[model samples]
Target chain A: MDKTTGIRKRAWLLMFVVVALVTATCGNGADDTTTTAAAAATTTTAAAAATTTTAAAAATTAAESMTVAKVAVLVPEEPTDFGWNQQGVEGAVAAADAAGIESEVAGGLGYDAPTATLRQLAETSDLMFAHASGFATAAKEVAVETGVPVVVWGSPDDREPGLAAFVSTSAQEGGYLAGILAARTTQTGQLGIVISADDFNWTRHSGGFIEGACSIDPTIDIELVQIGEGGYADVEGGARVTAILIAGGADVILGNGDGSSFGMIRAVETEDPPAGADKVWFIDVIGDKTSIDTENILLSSILWDFQPTYLQAIRDVEAGTFGDVNYDLNLATNGIALLRTENISDELWAEIQTARDGIVDGSISVPAADTRAAAEQLLGCGA
Target chain B: MFDETLITAVLVGAIAASVPLMLAGIGELISERAGVLNIGLEGMMLMGAYGGFWVAIETESIWLGFIGGAAAGALASLVMVFLCVRWGLDQIVVGIGVLLGAEGLTSLLDAATFADTRPRIGITARLDIPGLSDIPVAGRVVFGEPYMVYVTLLAVAVAGWVLWKTPWGLAIRATGERPEAVDAAGVNVVVVRSLAVLSAGVFGGLGGAYLSLVSAGNFIPMMTGGRGFMAIVLAMLARGRPLLLAAGALLFGFATAGTTALQLVGVEVRPEIVNSLPFAVVLAALVLLGRNEFLPSALALPYVRGER
Candidate 1:
């Protein structure tokens, strides 16, 4: 080989090696921060082990010393989703504000194992809320390793004495209300349920919606379409899928997705209604999107307010009983409520309010369907 | 159980879905023909989607959004050209880096810019052909698409003709096949490949903007949703033929919309099976049509003058 060619090859090799080393160095620096936090947590655990004479005394000491100066939440999507992520962030912030403490949010983390992020947030925060069911396992591991308390969703069995807590929402109750509203509002006698995934919250909500619609009209058609297994942000998929349901004669759409709901709303706004209906209506879940409802097609939303439950978690932490009990959000607890919109008439609103009262007063029960099969059964799809 | 409206909707949805894939596949076909295997096409599409949506929201013009998206994609392709084509970096590694970088940057930008008030633009205008648009079922499916679809088809035809008919096309193919021979023949190999990659970026960017502007009418994080990778597969399967790429893209689109139609018709199959229908269709198509398909000899290889 020529000398110049050999030198050029060697220079390229050296450049690659240098770049690799720089990347490794940066990666190790971040690792060191996590390692230091883990080590500190181990030291604190050992110190706690050495000092306590009894469990009662230890609990007392923890209650007195554990200061919740700041709380943090981790969500899988951007906090502006106006759904699960936004509600989680706003709830944590509200809880912190209620306690006169600071709140830190680490959002758009995706559905990956955020172990490093958990440790980083744990370093500066007193309590961490992993705001997604997908995050439960990793959050629990990080909570145990870092000696920081974590709150996970839909994992009641993961709750420990002080390390991890579990919280859940009965979004189905609100979905039942939405179903009632949809049943009342639909002119085509058909409703659509579009879920982005086979999510626990979505299935339960769908089940409740089916039951509610059936309660008002036994033969009301409810067509449920799942966009994909993990189509949480698939806006186009959401739009086309909703279009299919609309073409099948569904005029009211009970749309459940993080960002894909916007697509459903868009379809409802843009598409022509089915044969008998004059307009298509959209029913959203989690957060309210009335501000962005420029088309005025949003009938209502099954609103979820996490503030009460998050505040209770904070109170539990302060009382040294953080993970001792699991939290459940229900209509009775005021954790979930149906949003009132101008599209609903006074008489229909009165009927929805009565249904809500019945649910809270133990006269009505929203069926819990946590799986696709169970939800389909509730809709009589099996029949 | 499929009624007229349902049939029309499925057909319309299928065609709408195919447009982005066809545009991206055609672009990737051009790049592959020039011997630059762009594994970073997904990133370019994503950046285009973001850039396009941002421009559309700001200027309130969908056409300007498409242009902005193409420019953003071209801007992204410069990285691939500089690092892989010129500097001879590992194409796969650089492409993967581009994908990761685009995903993170777009997500961050969307959160930072539109977190408070998520904005959505109106759908683009459709050019319904006066005569064809009045026909039963076929009219809406063929003639009722946005004007961009026609432009994309025209672009595909032009690209195919240029790749086969023009001297510039010969230079691009020669660069991919025999860079040394091209260099000996007084053609700048790097320039040819760079131009090909830039064209790919524009195409991919246009596809992404179509998703955000024409299809969804909104920008969401990771909104391209693996369509970029799907385009890569279509391009590869098409074997450098633009027309075949269009067919493969339409096949995928039809399968996607057909799955929804089946579910809506109360076809009580497992969702896993239903969702896999599109991919199964592609796999079947690949098996049937992808016989003796050959890629460029120097594809993904960095060409340095006077070096093996």
Candidate 2:
């Protein structure tokens, strides 16, 4: 409008250009990428001139999304955990194979805060699956910084649309099934739920169990206890708590602790039966550890398969719906199911199948509970 | 609900939870008294757990496993001995490095060997006292425990006597309180401190072995679960008293057991409150009962012979 105003505006525009150039050059590990990306963008814009506006937009979108060549999976523990870590590594490999892409497993990274490893993996990976809930924050950080898509666990809200996605499991439905089985098979009618942590997944599953057990028989002695805040590897705590529960009229135990489940199994193996109970039985969760159960105490496990979940995540990336859509592995999709162990008899499995059918058909409604009180209420207990 | 079986269960569980903390605390207290604050107790315990579990499974003898566990702990502590005592490195830093190294090493070794099979060892056989084991509810819980339990209890008495009544104990106390003075007196402060740390490693290892063989019947990675840190805290609170440290450990154990009991009995408490109950009690004790007077004067300070 005015001569001085025009001069000021021109100066500001020059400053902005300078700042952009400085940023493109100064950003750590992003300088070369920035230059290459800018050249590609110029080429794309030129190509778009001859195409329809909608087709141009679609092409631009396609160009922006990475052609995922290799996916890397990071876990807090070794894959030999026989539970979460093992399942996660196996799932990542399976998904990579299905998508005809390469997969790298970086497991046993520990539970401390992460970012260094995520950055290292991002150097070679198009997609990274951070297999622990604790790794979500670090994964999101790396995703935003590197423009590499990442899949994290437990936190759907942390999804950054195109950058990060999350996977949730139908743990409650599987938990409900476990409860019904426990109630049906229990000779003493005293079932105990042992959790290593006060995790949302544990609560969801434990609550489902309480609901199912109560449905079978109201006023059933359902003892619930947690080892610690997150004692995922507190094997002694698992054994100690389970032994106490067994002593306190609990013949059937629903145990949910990753590495700690072995302790529960140990207690079942060694401890004598309580006065009213004939034998001790352990129902587990996540990946099946039945192969390692030398004693036939492992009754069942509400399996949480991440293979389908990871594969779906890969497909969503290809479809350009990456973080825009959330994924849930549920009984409805056969993602979560009860592992039929030899300890579970034919008659029991038949009844379980009937329940499974009911759940699938919507005849049985398994309520979602992410809290202890809510789980208690679901079990018909006045919390 | 408060029947004999339930009472017995709670008490027995409490004992099981307390033993490792107690043994580790006592060991830490001895080290703290000698001026070397070993922060790698968690790592040492882990190594012991692995070593103990492996030996016990291989030998089918739980007693030998305890020995293996203790030896492993002592071996792990040699790093602390070399770095802190011999080379005059920062005690806290060395301790942390030891912990990280031990955790990584044990986990790597464990995964390499037994991660697939997940083998479990038989429980250590329990021993029952003649008349004392016949009491109503606390009978088996108090007197009829595994041989290691009695040994641990005896260890407390022996450690107390050694700490206050013996020349070596006096030397350890003097080294912690006044390393310069002890060195001047030709007591060999480094030797005393090294031995104290080694003792701590043995006890920490034994505690870890007890966890794998007697408590859980198997070893799991990072299964020590910061109990070694808790032991260090208990040591600080106990103020050079082995029996008091054991009491503090038991108090922590009881609080943890109470949380479980309350949950099992369907007590209507907030999940956050229930989860934090044990830690809350420990903190409350630390605030209320943990007097800071008797801490070793030169706890983590590396003694530099003639330096002021």
Candidate 3:
């Protein structure tokens, strides 16, 4: 081969090596890109973009003078998951619609460092919500880089004075209610908590569930199995762990995750009921799957409504009070509530309502366990 | 806490989980035994999964779904054959490109089609070996499984025999170890390498299909979850031996299910430690058993007719 040809081949090989290394280190999933149609179809103009930048820079409290024009959300997976991603995207959309603003959604970004996507989204957005906990550090970095106000999850300490904020949820309240429902309905006196990861939302929800189940029957057998440290998209692991929990005599299962929860639902729909139970019931969190529950095994879900939180964030950004305090979504604000399906009996539903009122009225206290060890202690299975 | 029923369930799950790894590993073993390093196996598997899921949804036939999956994988491999094998392009670059393309296409297709409804397939039927399935815990654990499991085991045996006991097998081995010698011996190195890559695609496709059709009973974006990479590692650890590849895959499967088993029985260890158990086992196995194993000398190098 000629000298030029040989040099070209070596250069090409080096380029390939770099691409392979990046892809490997970034981990597997769909590539991170934007849906331009989704972002561009909205009625956003240069005036709105200018107002957002001025408000972010001035940090002024003139809420009436500054108008929030456009907001965007970044999710690690597709919003169609009917779980965390979907809820976050829907919340952004709803908040934008409520404030008469445009909304942009950048989904399927995977778990890679979304510096590029975030920078692209910030060019047109007045505010951004980094939906996944995995995206927190990247979101903070990009917020400082692009001068766009960003919201993240479970990192209150990382919030900047004006650039970044965080959203926290009292999901355990909803979990406690679901636990009461499960404890009342379970035939085998066993409950299963299948966590796709040791996420903050999942850990707190599990702790509340164990406490609530025990409130009804202190001797209830509650088994918690984590699929993996980061099995959020591990559908097979979700199914396998759920099946094992079922075999261990858990009739009512509380499942947490994004796409992996679908696998848990599949396991419930397919696996035969344990020895004493005639049917298996699944309680989900963050999003409702009643529409897609083909086999009707879905009993309820600890629904999370981020619309109010997102809307308030937009308002705070306009008022120059962004990042002053973390946004909290709880049962009292109707941000966190339990779904009541037809599968639940009227009498049981009434009892659940009373419990809900008690929780809202300060007559009940739900334990908040934000870690696996804390959750296990609540379950009386601490190491 | 460790009852017969729980033990039986764990064993069954381990076998079910191992099937995909074994299928993909054995296929990769064949490809590596030839002169090609199939880095795009993950991409091929993802394409197969998408094809299998789309076909299964449209046709409502599991058999056709599997066929569609295999065809899709082969179709993806044809890209590698044309680029790396025929044109003698850089295999690593082409493989990574194929993987990225597959991920984007599958995710986009899934979002457009099933993101709204999220339709799920019904329960897959398990085949019970008539007499053996009735023999208590061992019977159910060993004899009852999806039919694909048996087919995969048979494939492992066939792969082993073909790689060791056939004239064509020697050609494949020789091509990997010394492509120039194979070309001089009138074996048509290009054709042999192409066939090996195509086989890898077919096997990888079936593995992906088994995952969507039997294991998860539905397709999620990126649902293969790095199993393709795991298969590649197993294939490397096996050193071109199909039987050893199968064993390594099974070990991974058991280790995965065993983590859950340990947690289910209330083992007082940290989850981090329990989760790392599988990797520790694999590393230990590699250190002890794979110490002397070596990859083919000519693997991953594009063969040129007149070049050294």
List the global CA lDDT of all models: 0.83, 0.82, 0.83
**What is each candidate's fraction of native interface contacts (fnat)?**
0.52, 0.60, 0.49
DockQ, per model, reads 0.47, 0.47, 0.44
List the candidate 3 regions with Cα displacement exceeding 4 Å.
Answer: A1-65, A138-147, A158-163, A319-321, A381-383, B128-135, B180-186, B266-293, B305-308
Per-model TM-score, in order, reads 0.87, 0.85, 0.86
- Give the CAPRI rating of model 2: acceptable
Against the true structure, whose lDDT is highest? Answer: 1
Kindly list the per-residue Cα lDDT of model 1 for residues B1-104, writing each as its tens digit: 57777887787777777898988888888898888989999998998898899999899999999999999888888999999989989899999998898888
lDDT of 2 by residue, A1-383 (tens): 69999999999999999999866754543345533433333344446453333333433364356677889999998787778888889988998999999999997788785788987787788789998989988887666555567898857787666678887777899998999999998988899888888787888889889888887888788888888777788887787888788878889999988888877888777665777677899998888877777667888999987778888888877767788877787898878999998878899899888888998899999888877667666654443
**Model 2: interface root-mean-square deviation in Å:** 2.0
Which candidate would rank higher by TM-score, 1 or 3? Answer: 1
Rank order (by lDDT, best first): 1, 3, 2
Clashing pairs in 1: none
What total of clashing residue pairs does each candidate reach? 0, 1, 0
Clashing pairs in 2: A77-A108
Task: For candidate 1, give the docking quality class from DockQ.
Answer: acceptable
